[model samples]
Target: MSSKMEKFSVLMSVYHSDNPHYLDVALHSIYDDQLVKPDQIIIVADGELLQTQNDIIGKFISHCPNGIAELLQLPYNVGLAAALNTGLEHCRNNLVARMDSDDISSPDRFQKQITFMSTHTEIDVCGSYIDEIDPVTETFISTRKVPLTHNEIIVFARKRSPFSHPSVVFRKNKVISVGGYPPFRKSQDFALWSKMIVNDAKFANISDVLLRMRTGNDMMARRGISHLKYEIKVLGYQRKIGFITTGQFIHVLAIRTFFRILPGNFKKVVYKIIRKCYG
Candidate 1:
């Protein structure tokens, strides 16, 4: 079989600290899935991993029913963007998928997504909905549906993350064409997606909740003010890119501030309501 038709690279950038606890859930999901065999599960770990890699991941690496896994330990923390870019450099296949250490994917996640991408030639990036599971609280935190249209995605960043970064799959050629992920601020995925869209990259999403994300937004209040600061920065970026005018950006800021001042879960409820109303 052709290389493009045969192999699919799965890039998983993780910290060594994450091992049998959360890592197993993520790896086992891929292993249990019968559809796609990873070309290589490139794990960008740290020096702390070198010792534990042999004990923890070594067995799974050998026994993964589909893919053969490998380890890449960095001397220091290069951050998520750098780690993912390093893995992408080693990817031999045309297709790429992201898997976080903490999320669980549907059994057919890779197979279904790669198949859709194969059928749809125009689209370079595709993401799926997520069943946001708060493992700590042991409660279902509702579902997150990624944007299905280019325009929806542009609007998505203004509120919550439209594309679950770990749930996204894309063509390697297209990702490289846009210069891959940038090591900028906390929003590396945001930066990369914006760059891709600005370059006319086509995006799509599977409406189904094909992944389960471990929700940890309970601490948003501690950094509430900082979160607003990031939104403002992103709005500024939009203005610079000509997506939103200065006046429109300020309008968004005004509405965001108004919502912030409301009672507990008010903004959250509003977002859920908007999803339902729109759906």
Candidate 2:
């Protein structure tokens, strides 16, 4: 079916195990992302951790479309992939967009992304640029841009992930056909994109930045190391598709290192200048 004919579910996993205020902030961002009402927004919590999440669901339900927000507490900490799979199963939609419990998204995020998917038929998954937030100040943070086409992004595997996980809005059918996310692991988002790319799945990125990712304490905080690991692994996957000489791979690592030490505020200034000069 065409994306134009699709309804979407914004699936998020909650760990009442997590801090309360951050969760509230996340839901507010989700509601804000939907320019048009979504099919529903479902939250899943660990079963052993149900009561904890029940309190949270009760607190946030009124913030969304009537009958649009709901929660499920799983029997255990089945891992993020498993919890999300459970949410996907219950909330039927032609498209699925991943949302982290602590990030913020722009108000037109879904409207713009879904409309893009509707016209670009060949692309199976798409993502947009994001701003990395400073958790302490709750202020707007550094922006990161990604390449726009499959070929450009495949080359991106030579460095860090070219796309932001939370900024992705994708075709659900393609995800399931590619085997969804792996069970009990980190870099599940990276793995999903890699697997799809290896199988010739199409991709694209919007030129505009659409998400605000809070770092330092969020789930992706292990980025400094975990990303290095995922990059090496992604490089290996790309090599299986073609050739990546040892020299080129090392160069990629050097570039990644340069971006890593870059001061956040400095990077913000640099991006602002770029946006003004070119955008």
Candidate 3:
């Protein structure tokens, strides 16, 4: 490790349904493939995982240098937000990078983010664009980009998520100071961003893509009515926090609910159009 580089921890949460192969790929990308590796890798097992998943995790622990990998096992499954909060408490470094079990991070992802955070000490949270890929074939789909500067991100957060969750490296203390991730099962990242924004935490996103995110066909299916309910809760919280005005809240909620209720195929098309226009 370079003397100028500050040590950081990689935090990930895995559950029963996560694909073992995908988890293995994600692990290797952040460790073996990275130009700047993390000082510690904290994996929070959200629930009881399959034997195959455990085997994959064991192999990864063996591959890492001694004391680099730590596993925190949960007796039962909790949603992503709570699981991450648990993992956050275990992070040994003040700077922590968030990783998803099914994403492929670019080798230079950490190198670039660490360099940016080291120099831009004012930024508490930094994220980047992500390339969406087909989960089955790993084929390129499209890029999901976010705002690059603090002001732009604050404005962008009014309508959509200003940061890609898995592509972010954030200050641990800043996040905890804002009460960590909110309790929403969905749109928790959006809610967290709103909380941080209201708390005056600085944010930024790199203009370049730093990770390949797996988007399965069920992506649209996952955004059904239940998802919309949590989204509405998040929007309500945003309004309460003064992150968005009542008018903006109603307008965005109407648009989101309309798309959420659309037929699956039609919803996908609508998403593409929206992404092209705003993403």
Number of the predicted model whose TM-score against the real structure is largest: 3
TM-score of each: 0.83, 0.77, 0.96
**Higher-lDDT candidate of 1 and 3:** 3
lDDT of 1 by residue, 5-117 (tens): 43677888777666456676677776666467666677777445645544566777777545467877788888788888888888887788899987888888877787777
Candidate 2 residue-wise lDDT, 1-279, digit = tens: 354645678888876566676777778777754575577888887555445456667877876658788878787788887887778777777677778887888888888887887778787888998877777666764567788878998877554466788888888878888777755355567666767876778889998878887763232333454456656665555455444567776786676555444566554554455434432
Preferred candidate (TM-score higher): 1 or 3 = 3
| Candidate 3 structure, TM-score to reference | 0.96
lDDT of each: 0.72, 0.71, 0.91
- Residues 1-279, candidate 3: write the lDDT tens digits: 233778999999999999999999999999999999999999999999999999999999999999999899999999999999999999999999999999999999999999989888888999999998999788988888788999999988989999889999999999999999999888898899999998999999998899999994359655877788888899999999899999999999999888888888888887787667776
Which is the leading candidate under lDDT? 3
